[model samples]
Target: MINEFIKNIKILQQLKDNNVYKKYIEYIRYPYFRNLAPDSKITFDFPVTFLVGKNGSGKSSTLQSLYGCPKGYSLGDYWFTTELDPIKEFDKNRNCFIYGHKNNGSVNEVIKQRIHRDKNPDYWETAKPIKRYGMSNSQRFSPIEKDVVYLDFRTELSAFDKFFHFLKFYSNTHKSKQDFLRFYTNKLKEAFDTNKIISYYTPNRNKPKVILTKAETKIVSEILRKEFESIEIIEHNLFKDWGTSIRLKQKNINYSEAFAGSGETAIVILVHKIFSASNESLILLDEPETSLHSGAQKRLMSFLIKECIKKKHQVVISTHSPFLIENMPNESIKVFSTLNTTGKFVIDNDRNYREAFHELEIENTNKKIILVEDKTAQILIDKTIEKLGKATQDIFVTKYLPGGADDINQRLTTIMEITDDTYVVFDGDQKKLQKPVDLNLMPPNQQDTSKKLKELIKSQTGCDVKFYLNGGDQSKELKEKESLKLAKKYLEFYKRNVFYLPLSIPEDIIWDKKFAKKLLKLMKPEKDFSLIKKTSSNSKELLFNFCIECYGDSDQYESTVLQFVSNWINKEDSNFRIVKDLINKLKN
Candidate 1:
């Protein structure tokens, strides 16, 4: 677990020099950290922790601050302190590994060793004995105490000469291909742990080359094939005075890294390095989604999660992919953003309201958002909005919430909290009832009417009425009137189309405009049907029932309404002016 190596991190008020800090403390600063919480504590509760933020929101800086500072490497100008695991009773030092993107455009993993000078480290000290505990830069040895290995994609494919030499030594020592592979895998793990710091002999003027047998080549090929479909290791080349080399085959063409797709090569290299990492190693991925398609990104993440869990490795990722973030435990995520001018801030991920809008991919922008009731309202609102010239390319774009009237309050609160430019458009039928009634409790008379309405609705419409009444006032008369009006408006929309379908059409009719029109008409029965209820708004219900008789189902009538509205909005029309006006009013 990461807590085993790093307990907590604290941003310092000043560097060792005590120079006046300008940005991190007073204003927006560099190297990622800004206005962080005092005694900021990040825990490793899950095997994987993801840091997500917008560009310049400090994801990279946070990673660097947490574990990216190599012992001897200069981190430019940033300062932070960490609480590490105390040295074991028998151990002389502690080591921490960090993997990150290096300044040279390559990924590097560094292992830094810390030795305690004071026997009694619990007490404060003006000065204490301390020294870098690991072997010299030229020497390599497995970490005997606390160690951290920072791995990056670039590092996985780097140190070409050393890698080839290591391969040669292992292949030469083991004749059995499987044994060679096992040994090879172990050595790679060692290299990853030590950051390739072990000693290497100076090469002689003539280097010895060791050829790999066909079986050995096949073993390597099979491994590559699993990652890259159809990719194979063609052969291994050993030169008398040169190091070892391997060739690859792809799509019947011989290729090397230089000629291969960088994405594929990067993936293979990164996966190989990960597989070679020792169990329980702290793994930090800057952005595994880089250089991968959506499918590949998901597959790689799944594979990595499984492998890390099985091996007890802890993984941290800093990324911007929703596909990566979705479905993970809520607490495992830490969302970062620079919304505050003073510094970056974190948003809670577990809030259900946030999750609901997250499904719409809401970003911090000036885009307009429209919250409506359901798919039917969504269609109507979108269609109406589109009729007002250009719908989506205006100064602000609009998206709708999928909830209905009852959800408006929560949706508005959540959305307005995120952005001020928003509009809540409810259905026209949601207008207040002519006579106010207690909405909190269902009335006995209304409850019976609801039952009758449900039966009438199901038999006449052949569609579930639950969705229509969801979040609606359950008053019998109001609901029935609203449903009838909605159905009436739908039929009106269909009849407005010159080619609206009739009762039925021949099965073999070609699916052209005529057949399409007939297919829509076939949704209804041939005879007219009437409801003999007396009401103030009987005209609307009468029209609705007429269309239901012709269409057989209220759902098909609604579908035709949506189709007509969609087509109407897509073409030249002027009826959306009222919607455009309402939106303008809401924004103002």
Candidate 2:
């Protein structure tokens, strides 16, 4: 399943880069919207994009904006000015957004604004382009013509749940309505059990039936990890007014959503809606992870991707689930953050899984912690650990701190104090900090204290503390000794846990002449190898440009390039041995 997911993602990336998804909304820019900065732009480079952030960070708002991008859809449908939450539109802050889509081999922009009129109320309509420098007075285009489906899973409820939980039923005056509900409920159950369709009329003067479908049954079963013989969508007033319930048949037993898990019902509805949508439709999902466990969330994501690719649909999901974003390209994930200065939401484009995890404060449950300098180092260390086999991989979780070597070194003591099982790996360039120090030159009195401290460190941490002394005056010496006394435990802990990569930096390892040639051959065999040497003197920039050139500046470029570097390092090279020894030390 994982391999299939990877393959599908690659296919999606290729399609995106090739511009095969013609109906995709290219990008959306907020000139003025609710709590969003002026001119905040988010590009849609992948068929499926995940909008991730803390609650109220505008993730759902972003989805609503997207929902309004297609023709015949309006953000007003979801968010409109009410007495409690009124949106006052003025000349300066009119609450509008602009989006771009490809038309006739050229990109065209459309502006949608909320217009408050006497009769229309809070209606969203296409407005003339806002004047800007260098803007062309071209003919205006309507919103991209496409089918749009917006599902807010957080608010999705089965008809049975809605009626029984919210509607009036306990009053004696409503006894007849309650009795009718019970009669229809029993009849629906019997129909489900007997594999028959049943119809019922409602006060709305409409008749609806419970119809079974094999395709929906298979998809819902695969996602929810259940074996369903059949699935039915039941629409009847007994369940709720103008709503639907799901019925699942397993083995010889049949159950409505009233008896099934919420996740099962949600998945059935989601699958039905997605499969029923037209090709090249726009699908927006808000918190699809609601009512779903991690495994089900993963399967749901897989199903979504498959459907998107098969139907040429564009999907944008607002979620906080790591499972939904797992295996997705970094370019496909847009993280939202609120600005401290203005308290407005902003979209961050250059982010990956590590940043998302950090921003979301997702806890790592692994037994061991591996801290590194940056994202590249985190990737390298994580991939190397994977090469050490599943046991080693499962035990360790790698995290990269923001600042470079200096910040990590500054926080080493605090980190060690927090977790004894923590290990730190620095880029090979930081090996300069590992210089040896001689404590023999200390005076007899200081030497006596040092000896006691060393033994204390050894006894407590099971590691040797080697003092790296520098030549200085007595005042400096006294200060150094006192500092050592205060931080002796972590210093020894660091000596035991700290290790460095064999290469100076990830760029050097990746752009090594031989390694670069191999990567070029694998990624673009037709390109001349000398082009690498002729590129920028800065290896990092050169590698970045190389990846962009080969991969067409897509979101997967970094991961695609680093994946080769990690794979090469995982081989039986001298660097691999160093990584192996580092892991062995952590294991012991």
Candidate 3:
């Protein structure tokens, strides 16, 4: 299901790039916003995007900015000047943002600034574009005309939680207080049993109705993993000045939000709002995973994607949930990182799931870990794993350590001690170090590290380790010696676990003559291979230059190149077989 979702998202991305599926707000840029660097821009390439980062990294601020993109919405609705937090009118650094939307086959930019007025303070209104050299002003446009539904899950409370926990009762005695609660509970039960609208005679009359449709009930059930006969909402004097309460009925069981799980109540409200929203509305969700379990979060994301496709809605979410971000296309995710020098958040738009996991400090403990020398090698192995099907892909995870083979080799003992399921892989160029004798040929630091590893293994097992680098072949003399059988046991562990790539380096496979030709045919058909060969000094340089020429020197160019390389390695070739065998061993 996740694979299909990702494939559909990729198709949508292609359509968006071709201008076939136009988005209301194409891109947003902020020259000076709170905690964000100057001139930081984020493009809404996909209809559904995720803004992910640590706490206080401006994720919610970015979501607020998007919420303010459509007409009739303003950031001041959420962020306003208080007594302690005031906005200065004469500040040198202004708070403003600019966004572009598609207008009749062209993009029209609108600039909004926080201007202080006598009547309205800290108000964001449309302002004239700032003049820049060599730039001319076309016809200005107004804010986008679309309905917006902004939901901050963190602040949302179930109808029951809000009423009982926050509201004040007139009775001061304990007995009177119990009677107050019983009166309200009985009234809510009567309303749910009769399936009738309940009204309250407060300063402002209020009536709550059952808003869930039959289809919406099923969706809510699936998302929350709960089956309900019926669900109703009641807003009466009991919840006056608070909010509505939800009454759920399940096979001989009846309860309100007071007894139901928090996640259940949140999903019920979320589904209702989404189903009732108008088509093409801009839906902004802040931390939708607030109370949802992992499974529920994924189902909610899947439902959001399906609804976005159906209604032509633009959905943007700010979250810290890996489950929500895992199945999303890398292009759909925008990572925010704080810079130490400036103490501001900077956008990193080229991160994949593994990199995002590292940023979030999340570890997939269920999957087997395969450690590689660098990012390129990791990509290659990951692509190969994908070809073995979804089950294989789900069983293994690849992580790349920086500083190449030396890093893994230096920390080999520590890594082994940490997890027995972990396996180390190196580039084919480092295959020379497979033999113990070759340790002497390494640099001084590496030689000392290798000696320490050897000594440690011998001391622990009381056996001298030997490496049969070539398919674990043992000499006749060594095989006959029963005394060295323990040595063979140690050799078998390394032989079975450690591995090297089939090619000398990642560039060799990525820039192979045949693979490079195929990639060029798709990316740049007019450019010949001779141009790349003559200009580049080595295979790595050739790969880099080809990517630059084809995709330009953008932040996404490197990932674009690796994606193509991964596709090339996904074939049923010698290298694929080698990687597949290694993965099978790990699986066993």
Candidate 4:
């Protein structure tokens, strides 16, 4: 079955890419001022746009506004219109296609309409039978030169001697047919008290082949005389007339009356319509999901997508089903709806997903480690470090797991268990945020750290919280007189926000020089904190950074002496033992 579908589409549209170029012609969207919008609305990122608005919100009206009701322009073949360009807006028009509606419009539906309308050009051209209570039966083809084989039921005609034509033609305009009503369509009942060949699919090794009975083959070869010298049908039976009624060749097929039901008839006609226009038409389908099960709907959509691509036809479908769009690319999908009385925001991205939440964990480490919050930041870290002449691999950087602050502590445990070198840098209150609680974490007095630290403030007008990106714990240089400024502009354009709105994170990451210095200060233990005796760590850069951070201003001479003395002690490896041995020998 799959192979047959593929082959059918393959032969029909194998013009390479060139064949599809002809189809690139987009049906005109006549730009006109819609009262729905005060100004011209522009949209993008999707090749097809389906309008969906509440009734009277101009969904149908918008479609009408785009399409011209040319006598020939119709949404379907079932309408009649004689209104001549009610508005003369087409003098400057180049290319446009607007068809009548009322009858469902699809490739199949459009093809049949085109065929019926083709022969009735004279009647449709002048009277526009689409809604004119079109005359049926006994109406000869105008010009009387071409042949038309009308296959309509006998019930549509009311009188004898008046020819019987298309179905349900009771008026100059449509008088709805009871047979094709929706209730009758879902019986799961076959329409025919009829005899016909049953076509079935079979496999030849791996390829697909159509199988048919002899009678069915005969009918197909007879009707299809153009291409095959010998034709094969895909069904297994043939219709036979028995005493003024039709019956199937298979047993248990005798119908008391022998006429096919309208449901089956509709399916036949619809299929014919699609097959005919499969080569050329921009088929639009609305609510095909009606009367279809979820599985059927999926199968139908799959068939349609394959056919459109293979036949190189353009198709636009409107659906609210998320399942239908899961297979489509994000940019190819556009959501059209109004969020306000005045404007509609168009979402061109179809693949947008909510960001998973996670925060970073910071802990003491023997080695230096850098951590970032998200993918964007992760990318920036790698790229920025590369730009700064540092190899990414040289700087062990990782992202924290997503979630709230608790996730940060959870992640820290995981990382600390694996490596000794790690550092976490992010944002919090500008007053110098600390772990577990930010700088905003205050005593019950609410006197605020900034208020008490005023003795260290040069500018106290900074924001409540700001982002601080600090590293190299050696720079404990907080100005005794400064306060952080709050900024709201940075968080507004995260680029991942669902509606591009700012997220309400506690204290949007704030920054200040003191924020960097505070980490260095915190590294020092209390006076009771034990210092390493004979520390032999090879990473001198980190140790120096720590010393500068803790005692940056303490005894400049002592600081210089500490570094030289540490170097001299490391150099004494064997020399110290040798000096001790020499002293003993001299004593002896």
Candidate 5:
């Protein structure tokens, strides 16, 4: 079934020239994290999109790159972001637009903000200047709004797009208060409406057994739930029939340009729904996967592209799960680096990222890559030094677990037989680890980095690491004892008000169960529970299981028999294999 769907639909890159936003005043030239990945640059051009890449690569910054947001926007997608789905939103506060959490954050903040999501999406209902807890009198859709029609998905959507068209068509003939009669009359005439794209999802009736039977067709029902979240429909381009009931019309350049005769009612809903959401508005959205299948993501991306053909609405969102991108053209997608005002850079458009990074094609001289705990530290070294004009062609930064030098070493031994200029950052935990460097297969980034540490300590704390081996000072402690003391100091820096995950941890699990445990360990168990980013060990397991089921695990690794199993950890696609396989595996 999936193979048929995949075969029928081909994903193309829907490239658009997205003008990334940034404040004029706060531009930084050499930003601290300037070369940070996707969190840096951000852009907007489509109504729905899917962003993909490794964590810390600036994926979320693409959504939150609008003005009025608290801090300048960065790139990224956390757990359940729809920002990648190309739906944008601003905060109801009319504050700067914002999307998803920090770059180094969990994936599902929108889910965390459930009530927040419901509040403003319904704001369009009160056309006559309805104010929330905090609002000035100036905000409203338009003067004397005509009508309002809450399209309930239950019965309304099953008839599909033309269903509403028939309503308007019938109303033109029989100008009477007989909506139910009009519906039956339309059905009698075989004037049933339909959706060209998401038609497979069209339900027949409200009764469970009518379209999808829970008892008999449980699997199919589950598939419907996964794809058509809740199919609500509208007939026209406008909202309202009378007194602004719910009008629908097609634009010359509609969301679905190919379907010229009449745009899908779904596209009209998108425009009106967005317009209806807020005033001087900011919209925050998770993945716009709801009510849309992968095929629809492509159509929506094209149709929504022209929304900017008229209005310029600022949107912020997050998405780690990308169903939309799977359908997009290759050249269309852009990669971002950071969210801060000045540090943003686009991957595709920027002559630099593609030319410098991809084109020259740095040598895999050290093709034997070193997976750092937070490869960011190594990435910073490589990229920053590259900025300083160094050929880092040989260095490739991957991941090891945070606070996990031992794990890194263990995994390293399995992968590469020979190690070269490899690096590891260890906490040097006394009880947990041995010395200045805990079970390191490779030393830290460089010997110079270690030497720099010596100078840093000498200048600040008046202690010399050179004193231990070179016999310079009698007062200094031994390397192991001094490392423990220094480790305590480092841990203190790490466990400050907000904990920073140490390097040597898995990139995905950077904010995973272990991170939650760290938060609990740092603070009280109950109170810190909320403070922890969503992924704790249990959440990690659950998310992984879910991923396995939705998309198969084969994409997990290139050359592993356990590719499917390895794919469990990756949140690359919505059709996540891990969750699907795990369930089937369990059943079998």
Candidate 6:
């Protein structure tokens, strides 16, 4: 399968001082190669995979990278590819092809390229070793494997015409013509339930020369009729150098190729190729979204996906169409884009997942908006707001906009214009919290909050607070002293609250397990409070589920903390509180 075959993509950058033009030795950068993080692993795990992104985001480059593997476009050649060699690896079966960009435009280009290719090349004059250097002229050709079918949205009816007529001329030597007819008829019968062919001859001609069999003429008519219901195939010439010139009868008027709509012609040829194709071949599609209407795109993708599932064929697409990407699995969607403030190619899986959810309208939204980095921050903030019972009109009626941290910050002005009450929040990624619960700052009544939280932890796991903070005593260290193990258990307790409260972790967090794991390692020994806190100018909300879960009456502690933060912001303290500036401006 194409998905299993293409295992990974590693982006390389051109060396600063290089002897070779296309020689790429250095990696772009980890966590970000260009628009995507270099360490990101893009896997083809579905029968149909899609490459989607804004123009110049490397969607086209990534598509071309896969299609022109080993050598093709330069890493720096792309608009978004300042320095990135997007390399793709295939499994044992390196079977795939690339069909270039397609739409109303590409059908012309496809024909032009084929028509312009050098049919014959010069032979080597002397039997000497030939040296080929520099990046070769960009040619889009896939492996010559039986399991490959490179199809663009540029299926010309003339090509199909030439193919069918060529078969008729040399019908004796090849059995493939019969196979094509059988395949076409089988699919047609399945769709229309008719074994009889429909043929038409021009009525004006005293004796219309019928150079083809009735079945052959009828087959052409029937094939086109499916796409153009209003038109019927009237006549066809088989022996002409132009191959087949089909005349159509529409509403008592005769029409030929010149008179037919581009859309209708396209669909007829496209449908023919699809139904007649062999099973299990990788079908590469470019911009089907641009060529077909919304309804046609939907119907075609649905049909092709189902066909892939049944026949074990694979399909890959490069498109800017949301209609196409939204229907595909998140894992199957490869997004190409430039990261913020950095001119680098980013193969973003998390943002791609957002595209998928957005297509289904599954992204959570409320009447009011609270812009947060991701779902995890959204859940924590929503839950914390509820716990605090702030009674502000915003908390009861706000929805979270899960744009990432950088996006929210970049678009803060625009978001504020939408609603003055909009607040930005993020996970505790700004800086490490040391002894998060400041004992000196705690009010007299709330002094026992930390002790009580510790007691709750001991009750749940039968481990003392010191055990978690100090990695246990020397004797108990051997039994269970690992900070990660303790953090996992603690995280589990808090994570349970998230589910019970009915909140799901965002894919961004899930995809990067190392980040979360390392976070826990950093915080486990720091005596950080489990409670959520608004930490930075970015509205970074650092909260562990264990902290939220430990409090018996989370409301009081939450209210107290909220009041303290509000007081600090009201003071407009410039000494230490970084978030004070943003909150104070909002308050005014």
Worst 10 residues of 6 by lDDT: 107-116
lDDT of 3 by residue, 1-588 (tens): 778777767766666677664557888988888889888889887888888887788999999988888788899998889899886544555788889898789887887789888898978898776764111565557888888888888877865566567666565443554576676667667666675555544333236467578889888877775667777775655544556678777666667777765676777778888898998888999998875655678888888877876777888899877778776778788889888999989987766654665554333366787888777788888877887789998888888777566545534423332346667777887775445333334465642333454664554333444321210112334323422333333334455557778778876766667777787788888877788788998777887777776767756656866765666665666767777787888889
**Greater-lDDT candidate between 1 and 4:** 1
Q: Candidate 3's C-alpha lDDT? A: 0.70
Model 5 TM-score? 0.24
> Can you rank all candidates by TM-score, best first?
2, 3, 1, 6, 4, 5
lDDT of 4: 0.30
TM-score of candidate 2 on Cα atoms, chains taken together:
0.61
User: lDDT for each of the candidates?
Assistant: 0.40, 0.73, 0.70, 0.30, 0.30, 0.37
Candidate 1 Cα deviation (angstroms), residue 392: 16
**Candidate 1 off by > 4 Å:** 1-39, 68-247, 347-588
**Each model's TM-score, in the order given?**
0.36, 0.61, 0.60, 0.29, 0.24, 0.33
Clashing residue pairs in candidate 3, if any? Answer: none
Q: Give the TM-score of candidate 6.
A: 0.33
lDDT of 1 at 260: 40
88 in model 6: Cα distance from truth in Å?
Answer: 18
Candidate numbers sorted by lDDT from highest down: 2, 3, 1, 6, 4, 5
Model 1 global lDDT (CA atoms, 0 to 1)? 0.40
- Give the per-residue lDDT of model 6 (tens digit) for 328-406: 4465676665567766655645445445433322222343334555544444344444443455334333234444444
After best superposition, candidate 4 residue 69: deviation in angstroms? 9.6
Give residue 225's error in model 6 in angstroms: 12
